[model samples]
Target: MSVDDGAVAIIGWDPSLVRETVARGLRPVLVRDVPAHLRGTSIPLPEETEEIVVEDITDVGDVWAGLTRHFGERLHQELRGIVTFDEFAVSTVAALTSLMNLPGSRLERAVLMRDKHLQKQAVLAAGVPAAASRLVVPGSERIRTPFPGPCVVKPVAGGGTAHTEMVRTEAEYEALLNKLALSATSPFVVEDLVDVAQEWIVDGVMQDGVVVFSSVGRYAAPCLSYTTDAEPLHIYRVDGTGEDERCAEARAFAGKALQALGYTDGVFHLELLLDRSSDTFFFGEVAARVGGCLIQEAVLLKHDFSLAGGAVDVALGRPVQSTSETTDRCVATTSLHLPRGTVVRLPNSGRFAAADDIHEVRVAVLLGVNDHPEVRATTNWQGLALVSAASLAELDARMAAVRGEFIEQSLVAPTFGTGVQQRAFLADYEDAWRRLL
Candidate 1:
């Protein structure tokens, strides 16, 4: 029986969607100060009708136990259902998996999705088109696979494309293999580069092992180009009916994958690469949650349908409707490309927030902060710029305008010396002398 109102314990918070649900009147039993809780302190549980626990989902052991104990203590009796929002909520997944015996609900499929090698194997077994992939262990000189085979290599699990490399030649492949700091246990997954004509994301909501709502979002910019070149990335709802061939094909294929994976009552994001070679859909990757970044934010602001919100509604058996057609339009987000340089001067602050179409701009890499190693790649910029428009052209124009305004300034590199010596050195440099002396 449904109580007065159901409580949702988000496994993780900070996605902003979780906060939004709380704003919508759903009581979220947050695990106050997850960091402290993980450090072995008993978290104070809020006395509410429902208890929702949100924690950082990572492989760390302490968090696992803390979350596990709370779920067993609070949710074991009064909770209707527990919703996991964080990727590393292994304990939560384990608990749910043990309770419902549902594969998708427990996110075993998420493991397959996280491990590129495993994901490919799962798809291939189900007759879903996929690129050839293999596990590569370091220093196996017998590692003879034709070097430089238009392939990509990356870590077996985790987010972000860090340490991701493309090997087009034998020498580069060898260099990459040698460069990777691998142990006996460390392994990487190498995949044959697919010839993609177009790329799209299949976003959907699953209920009781069935896909209730599905939509296709086409990418206007290439993944490599936008990520590596620091160019703007565009993803918009495709202009077509549900019966459109590509749409139907993608839906059927994605639904099958979901079925095979045993997902139920959750949001799933799957990436598809339309192979130019044979006009087939090649699986790229998937996430058991909403796509990282502003995709969900757009859905909330533009369309009233919140997959995050819908998850809570489903937990309570509330009415959930599909997002409107008006939300189907061109949308794009650009990772603010702050190159490796000292921020000696910052351009006019007004110019940064000037564009009408630009929604948000955040500078993650600040003046005093060290340059992020991952952001060195064109695809891994230090900040993000979000923009939306009615047309792809407009989105592109607005993103370009925002990127054009920022100018990097040079500064004398900070060197380690005694405080007095450092001060003396600074006095010698004209810029530092004027600013500090």
Candidate 2:
């Protein structure tokens, strides 16, 4: 049945995806609060409309209680199923798996998938090549590694590269370890850095513990910079099912990893580093939900598949369609990650309206005068542009031109009353905005 006829509940962090799901016809009862403007953009409720609930899902307890309340009683009373795109859902779903009297393996497996340390252990035990990793628990700084160099450090349970640190030397590594506040006992993983030949992404749905539909992605830019940058940038490879050996190996490894993790049902997003130097595929990470960035959109446009919708179907024990034959003629997405401390303003966005390939320009960051954070300090994404190119080369050229024309011209020195007062001013401003919002 079409989503219009069926309602699904979405529990995830990314509000944008929640908005997109509702736009696609599935009545999304968001488990997270919707921004005011986004609420304004939502489709108006019909006279006989299906109810859509939006709640604050800042923690795991909130999610568990929310799901049980919705699925246990709400589903039977109204046709509904749970769909999620955030890591927190893994734990919530795991908890619900037992209480709901459903298959618990998928949820248990997802915990292993979401936890980098657990995932690495499972895959390594299966004989898959992976970077030597250590789960830096609280007060556990004396961790040793055989090949520690240019080690990668990332939060044990965060995505989008937030809080991810790269230590290239002994000094940097030691500093990072010291500053990590190992006393907190929070989980962080440090892994040996590998000279990556190519960055790739693979995703698909599994049915009854077997692979059904899958595709691989090639990143146009490096993962290191992609994770830690603001300003419109493109990082995409190709998404196709062709007779390429490299693609085959990457796909095979993805399938193997999913099976090894015992992920019986649901969407799996896997990242791998192809070491052409050794002709070996190294597991980077995996998410039980859809891949972050534009991969979710890319998957839909390139493969005519909806992992989100399929996931809901699987959770409801409904039938799912195969996505192997879907393909996008051409698609590209760029994160309009403007530089911090660059006091810039949005021009007549309609000026770029005539651009042939540029389909949509979304400003995630609002237009306002605020102190930009320092370099390496994380801020919310400024904006994103989804362009539809006629060809790959055209996509690249158009994105580069757009970046050059807009980001450069828009770059302006941030106004500063005084250097020392900047932090205090920013703090006040942030507090005001929070209170106002």
C-alpha RMSD of candidate 1: 6.1
Give the TM-score of each candidate: 0.75, 0.78
Clashes of 2: 11
lDDT of 1 by residue, 263-380 (tens): 6666778888888879888888776777755566555544546777666555545555665554545555565554443444444444555766666665545455335463334335
Which of the numbered candidates is closest to the native, going by highest lDDT?
A: 2
Candidate 2: which stretches are off by over 4 Å? 1-7, 13-27, 33-60, 67-79, 102-105, 138-147, 182-185, 227-233, 240-243, 323-328, 342-344, 347-356, 369-380, 405-413, 416-437
lDDT of 2 by residue, 1-437 (tens): 24565455556444444454465555666565455324444234433223323454544566556655655655544444555677656666655544555533345776787788888888899988898878775345365333277888877777666667777888877776677674434578888887887778888877787767787777665577554554344645365434267778888899888777888887888889877689688988888787655666666666777676666666666566774555445676676655545454554456666886765556555445545433232224565656667678778778777655556545433455557566665676678679998
Error of 1 at 128 (Å): 1.5
Candidate 1 TM-score over all chains jointly: 0.75
